[model samples]
Target chain A: MAHRWKNDLTRADATPYAAFMNRRQLMGGALGLGLIGAAGAARAAEELVPNSWEDITQYNNYYEFGTRKDDPARNAHTLTTSPWTVKIDGLVDNPGDYSMAQILDAMTIEERIYRFRCVEAWSMVIPWNGFELADLLTMAGVQDGAKYVAFETALRPDEMPGVSYPVLDWPYVEGLRLDEAMHPLTMMATGIYGKTIPNQNGAPMRLVVPWKYGFKSIKSIVRITLTEDEPPTSWNKANAREYGFYSNVNPEVDHPRWSQASERLVGGGLFARRQPTLMFNGYADEVASLYEGMDLSKFI
Target chain B: MSIADRINPLARKLPTWVVYVLYLLPVPVLLYMAQTGGLGREPVKALEHELGEIAIQLLIIGLCISPLRRFAGVNLLKFRRAFGILAFVYVVLHLLVWAVLDVQTLERVWADIVKRPYITVGMGAFVLMLPLIATSNNRAVRWLGPLWRQVHLLTYPVVLLAAVHFIWVRKGFQIEPILYLAVIGGLLALRLIPKRARVAA
Candidate 1:
């Protein structure tokens, strides 16, 4: 009755949820079916890095899901994830379309415990479920001219009420330097907390930029363009002072209007003392290499 | 006391029943949450925030009562006292949650206020609510006598403090808090204009 996956399960923290589903399947006599039937938590958890998916996605700065803390969770239930596809184009050799099913089939997902830092000054430890971007880029065959990789999420105003805001440029945009994109720590996340991606948290596909602020991670992606240019991202374009393209997690590069030194966990209650934000979000060992010899102060 | 013994029957009974009923609203909300097994995983904090926001919204409505009577012609009068008390209730609950669960000590609480500007503003706003709460009852109102008018003026300061609390509470000036401030500010300003000046001489 035990799940094939366990805590030794990897970054996406598929252990607990998968264990639950395996037990459920064993009891239902559908154990050998080998496919999920409402074992959603398992799929999301296993597929994503553990805790990588917000215990509540509403806390995410993706106002594209709606502004309130609980709005994204409440409203994101309407998305249809099965029909999803991500188009890989531009400087890539495999400049074509790929379905969600195909993308999953092509790569093995790993769980990475990433300390998520928001520009607003909050932090979370999330085990994300996704493979190295280098592996995916390797499949796509990045061209020599490719300096950055751009990501785009689907823009449907009907379901995503936040997209109606003039505050942002419709579809969410994010980019990574070629080296950052190719780093082992960078991932194309599809699920979290051992389940398929939640509709609100950018299901099917999203990117996890560990050392950067949460917004830099980008969610609900539809297109990935390997380009020679440094892409103008949505947040940076909206407020240059608040959101920089590098968006590194550094206490020194304080958010223009607020201090970056400490953060409070939303839903962590008013009483939870704001904790000092760790430099590089505690991922300095893994990700600090990407920015070697570069001054984070100037870049940030 | 019998209805015949009441000095001002309508004044005495209507406000009393209204206050009692008003005080009862938050109970159902709290109960349903309790029945739902305490607002889920991070129940205390989430519930505290929800209750606090609802309370603030109610205060805004209460502040709107006179404007409602003048402009909308709604008999929202009976609800004003209730609104004020409920807003105070939520504010108190908001503080209690922080003081007990979050801070755990007065020293730590004071330190938090000093260390963080938002916390300082938030606690200061809560302190402002104390006098307004004490003066809400007829006994204290009668005891203070003419000073009652001046003491109740704390409402004006409380409103400003609440706005300031919310402004600094946000990482950046958020739209919702700003909207609340503008609306609330406009209403309070409307109260200061001389009423007779508007009428023809």
Candidate 2:
């Protein structure tokens, strides 16, 4: 069945590639535009300015590499993403280790510009190139009684410095309900801005659930399991009080240590004011129905 | 000559204001880096963390003064006041950056301070420093006499709260913040040793 969902954001919405390469040029360009066309530039500024590829690739929360934001960028190069094999099992008809080449051959990839909101109250607009998660699940053949889908990240202690520290339970995990997993908005991202994703930004492949907080999008995926029981998540296991399993982006449901009502936009320079966080990270219109009967505050 | 005897004469010759100047040198450099993209993708956050870390470092250095004098025979006692004042200045800059550039709205700032435990703890540390900052001058020190030492004892709780704030602000049980807390706990524990025991040593 073809997905009915259409992308509200276009390529023009993305931060320019040239600008990503040199931010000084972008600033100078913005200043030049402001001088020439004040009203037009003001309107342009009002529109979403997706984070540069540098911002997305450099600042990451991939704890497998390390805890610090820049640690992944520095250390993740050692991870061997090539010849990767993902183990797909549990309640699926065709359960086996599918090679990355096979998966890419089987799926039809597309671009999705999404607003990524982190649980830490920071956000970025990312343009991802991937296939819908449903397509991959359908290919694997999800069996009956599979209520939930669990995902795991590759754990390599030698390659990943952060794993040795016990920053998070090794092999970080995340799960989503079967219905939510089948949603068209749920994606298996392979690249960013038409380039193969850098190791720091979850190389080879990663899950992208725009409606949920960024952590829910498990990176460097090694395993996918379709199960009846709700699987544990890394952040939730570390501190259940602060990080809920659902971990949906909800302004009303603040993290115990910090408020989620507003978020700082990355690559907006030092003086950029924090913008009010949107419910479902501005994808509520498409995904709000998925949680229709359930209470978000309780789940979060 | 003893190491202290050799170093103390030069230390005394160096004006105390040089300590203030040296400590404050990073403020402008950090601000400039933040403006020019040298602070990385999230300059605001990097700036905030850098400022807060510096403030905590200053507080830790302030805690080191008595220990350095007693255990190491280093007489940095005269520069202790500059460490406190500079730490307070960094804390103020950190708070201002969050309130003005980061939070932007007054209502949200107040709500965050009230609702968030980490922010509440951080703000509590900031509030406790007020009385200490007010009485840091020589006139107030002389006027309060022995009572001044009792009031300045607030440094223990302030440093503890600051460290706790750092730990609580982290997403997970990170070693960096925990190390800060451990160092602070150790420094404060050093005060428990009797002066007679120290003299005996």
Candidate 3:
């Protein structure tokens, strides 16, 4: 717990459910800690909220459900998260489809309050319950040659509408350098706020890499493939010029479409000033060393 | 009777200031929505987008007036000034919102205008419309005579640039923006038809 960075945002930062939903009649501010999946350990400044469960669950960029932000909340309920299985293959000594329950049973879970920065430049602070990704890689027995970790999200066309759009080649894929994958801060989140993650927010299991843009944290993952070579990521494949594989939150490196210098905080109210974006989304102190000599602008 | 004959009397019955207020109603509505948190998650961004879209839509509608009269026999001339002025005002407000609220950094706003192609094109459209906005009054129209009409013709290029700005600012293949471009292109194409051919048809 001492090593884990804590967010200072308390329950006060969260918008009440009624206000968040834009209901005309304001409701009493009831702190719904029901969503906190595990016992809370960190004390956070009231700078970031878990974005009110309604905001977290309702507004999402799960393209699997649809392209519009609200599409997932409306469409993802049909997804069967229970009885889910993840195929761990490639450079791991143990290669098989392990049930979600089996994987959770084998790991220790902790609550982590992390800033969720999107490549689109909006951000959120989420309280996630999960175990470090390193633990899972360790359990699977990473082979000596593995240099990168590739991940694939579920590709259920019958369930996920956006797959129909050629937004990207489907069975959405992402990867992290082996070192990045094994970073202590990188976790496989199972729940948010203190409850089982809602369907739209990638229920059952998802990846949370705070230092990188939100896209790098692939959601509703069904496959984890360790490899010796760099793996193709979804966005980088969609547009190489805009989305780089690393996708680290660097204010200096602008997205070709928009500036990465500042981000509008989700739930920050209409007139809330956009805060300056931090280098590596303020995790530069921890993760900057990982890309010590790499030319980020070129790589990006 | 022609639409111009019938509607001209009805339009004349309405006072100019009342028409102006009616034309400019969306400003207060947008401001109210912004204050009340009705603009959704990112309200400023939403407001900026809505205002910009409204400005472009009005610009397109303003461009459509002549073509509508020429091809369809619908005379909306009396309202064109209202449309153009409201569009210009909205564009100014949209730019201000981006600068004062969205960007909040003078240096960044300047950089965005200079460096970004979409912003550059958008700013170009606004600057092109400035003279048109300035000379919108009756006195300027009377003084400039035919030369005023020639300067107002800048609307064509401004529409094209604004439409291109709208298209360029979006990410990926968005159908709505392409549809907007198609509408603008259709209006511009209608203007290209010979006057006698349009009348005969």
Candidate 4:
């Protein structure tokens, strides 16, 4: 009952992380209560975050925690949330483990609204409040042999029952090419809805690779390893066809199973209709330059 | 002959109440359709959610019978035929919903079953249930004898497949489905474990 209705139009463009969190805490963070009272008021207004509440909950592609829309929301609670640490190692020159508290203290978290696209053909525009992934790499000190940046989640099968699945090797792993990892659009998310990330959402740490499918945004990261060769990714090794190494959102490269032309917007009614999925999920202007002339079909 | 003597003897001899109940056995599916907007406005997702749920529930009911008759000393064997068919009905609905609404194409559907591990398992379960459902009548049961029970034991594989299907459909694993899987798994395991078997093997 802390937040019932919000007048989003007149509110701060980017509320301080603490101020936004304080209001969100009062409102209980149930999508749109404090942020949006009516639909049409901001019809033509510019928003930093691209997602609506329905899209946020419905298009969940959080594979690091588990495979259900609500699974991560449930099992991710046991993460040793605060006082977190990230090990920055491998081919990096300044290889060391840094404390989560230190990272937060050293950096200013910003609010950037992004449209999230799932490979399953759904999309959401979410306003993520976090620091940049590049800033962290700069802080970590990347070196020459670092061709790939690999991320690892905490491997606590006891706490997370999903790890019991012999589907693949435990300790969910995701990786990015060094250039992709350091892209400006790629973020290191710490909070959402202007508040500290809730327990179900990967807290303490996670990466946000905008321009790629949602799964590429790894979560609950405990280790960051910069490698010379392409790191062996968890999904590609598990099911190579449905998931790919690049896993970028490309309409030309249809998933082995489903159509990429359409998407079911969550919270949008069944038959409520879906929108056309864009190439690189509408971030083509900013990131398309990086993949220019590369055959997405072959790369995919 | 007196007018009363003209009544058909078959009607007089048959268990009219049993026939009526048997004919009305599809009430669960009917009720489910009505409650979930199967005939209402929010048709597709509503239909999808209901069918998925019913598919699992029907499978649960199918698994419940042997245990019920064994542990509870109950004669719920009477409803097993109807319930198994109900499970089939729900599964078909689940498939149809996925096919017509969820995936939306024959090529995509076939590719999905072939490409995805869970979809293959689900289709396998669906295929195995067909013969059991086709042979539901007493005549077929009597004809097949012990082979009928052996074929029906296919339910165990079906249960496993359904659980896998549930687990893999979402991008992340959900504990709710896992809990159901655990219960169904334990119960199915109980039926087979030699140490736990109390009835004459």
Indicate which candidate wins on DockQ: 2
* Per-residue lDDT over A1-300 for candidate 3, one digit per residue giving the tens place of the 0 to 100 score: 123444444454666777656521221122133322121111121244467676577668888888667789889998989899999999998999999989988987777878889888898878888888999999999999999999999999888877787667888899999999998889999989878888888877999999999989999999999999999998888788888899899888888767898787788776665666778877776789999899999887
Candidate 1 B-chain TM-score: 0.76
Q: How badly does each model clash, as a count of residue pairs?
A: 25, 0, 12, 16
Instruction: lDDT winner between 1 and 2, please give it.
Output: 2
Q: Provide candidate 2's TM-score on chain A.
A: 0.88
Candidate 1 docks at the CAPRI level of incorrect
DockQ of each: 0.21, 0.75, 0.35, 0.14
Q: Give the best candidate by TM-score.
A: 2
| Per-residue C-alpha lDDT of model 2 across residues A1-300, encoded as one tens digit per residue | 334466654766656778655754655576556442332233223445568988999999988887878888999999999989999999999999999999999988787878899999999989898899999999999999899999999988888888888788788999999999999999999999999988998889999999899999999999999999999989899988888888889888888877897788888898775666778887777889989999998888
lDDT of 3 by residue, B1-201 (tens): 977788767766766577578758888998898787666566777789889999998998798778777656667788889889989989999999989888877888988888888899999999999999999999999999999999999999998998899888765555567889999998888777787875577
What digit string (tens of lDDT, one per residue) describes model 1 on residues A1-300? 112123324543455877868765563554245332333223323332333234555455557767665677878877677788889999988888888888788888765555677776666666567777787888889999999999998888877877665657777788999999887678878767666767777787888887888888888888999999999898888777667899998876666555676565544542454555667875666678788899988788
Alpha carbon lDDT of residue A18, candidate 2? 80
List, residue by residue over A1-300, the lDDT tens digit for candidate 4.
Answer: 111212233235655689757754554452335333222222224334355543453334454456555666656667677677899999877788789988887776876667677777776667777887878887878988788999987787666766777545677798999998887788888887787876555676778877888878877789999889988777787778678888888877877655685565555444443455667876676778888898888887
Model 3 bad stretches (over 4 Å): A1-50, B1-19, B196-201
Looking at model 4 chain A, which ten-residue stretch has the lowest summed lDDT? A1-10
Q: What fnat does each of the candidate structures reach?
A: 0.12, 0.80, 0.37, 0.14
lDDT of 4 at A32: 34
Candidate 4 B-chain TM-score = 0.75
Candidate 2 lDDT: 0.88
- Stretches of candidate 2 exceeding 4 Å from the true structure: A1-4, A12-48, B199-201
lDDT of 2 by residue, B81-193 (tens): 99999999999999998888888778889998998888999999999999999999999999999999999999999999999999988887689999999999999989899
